[model samples]
Target: MDTEDTTGDLITRTGFHFHIRHAEPEDEAIVADFFKHVTPEDVRFRFLSGMKSVSHERLVEMTSSSDARRVNFLAFSPNETLLAAAMLAVGKDPQRGEVALTIRDDYKHQGISWEMLAHICRYAERHNFKSIESIESRENHAAIELERDMAFRAYTDKDDPTIVVLRRDFRP
Candidate 1:
């Protein structure tokens, strides 16, 4: 836990007694466990499909997938329990990034989602991404409200009934 990156920054930081860090391969199961707490309803809103349960194969794919510009972050409770998670994906173009976040159903409305989103945005900026996009179902008003704090250009999807795209540029 005391390992330091080449830049000399500590790998873990404390916030409200919780530890936030770049997730590792060993943390895959914990991420899977976190996904278990995310209900079908949550998936429905984000994926536009009512996914009852995620398969282990999918979990493995997510944790093992490698792209130089992609990074996943986890929020661990003081007890070292994964409470929430998010990912910052930089497109083939370094100037583009997109964030996807999810919080435990039981923990919703407690501000974890907002915190996770902010963390991912900051991460994206630190990596020099010029802009980030969030794709969500129009029915997910909470997500819409969350992005309202920033200026986003909205685009309607022609094929998807429940989807809308929001794009935001990161100002250094």
Candidate 2:
């Protein structure tokens, strides 16, 4: 079940081998289907809005390979089922980036998010980024706890009482 592609690498987690690669323009449908499987609350947590469905243009932006500042990774099971998606949006400062991730509801509590976050962090550090950040809903306790366990500092977003900004600083 091992494979490789131009987008990125393949890795196994908990006996399930999956590909962790950048999303291609042709992957719009796949991403759309992945979003369809996400819960409403999960969608709110991921988008920070009550988005019941992702728009086509937003999906295009997510799948676009031309955006140098943004990198979106889609994880697929060995059988080619989309299991999760993670994104990194680097800022103009180069040393800081914002990250977001979502896993299918059925895949939660299986160490997938942890592995994806670790992989994304390594990717950021390798690209010379100094820190990675995520804005999470205060009700997203699972994600907040996961980020905290990964050493990301969490702070209340003053402008939005319902949001918490979590940051992980990488050592040079």
Please tell me which predicted candidate would have the highest lDDT against the true structure.
2
TM-score of 1: 0.80
Runs of candidate 2 exceeding 4 Å displacement: 1-13
lDDT of each: 0.66, 0.84
Q: Report backbone clashes per prediction.
A: 0, 0
**Which pairs clash inside model 2?**
none
Q: What is the C-alpha RMSD of each candidate to the true structure, in Å?
A: 4.6, 3.6
lDDT of 2: 0.84
TM-scores for all candidates: the values are 0.80, 0.91
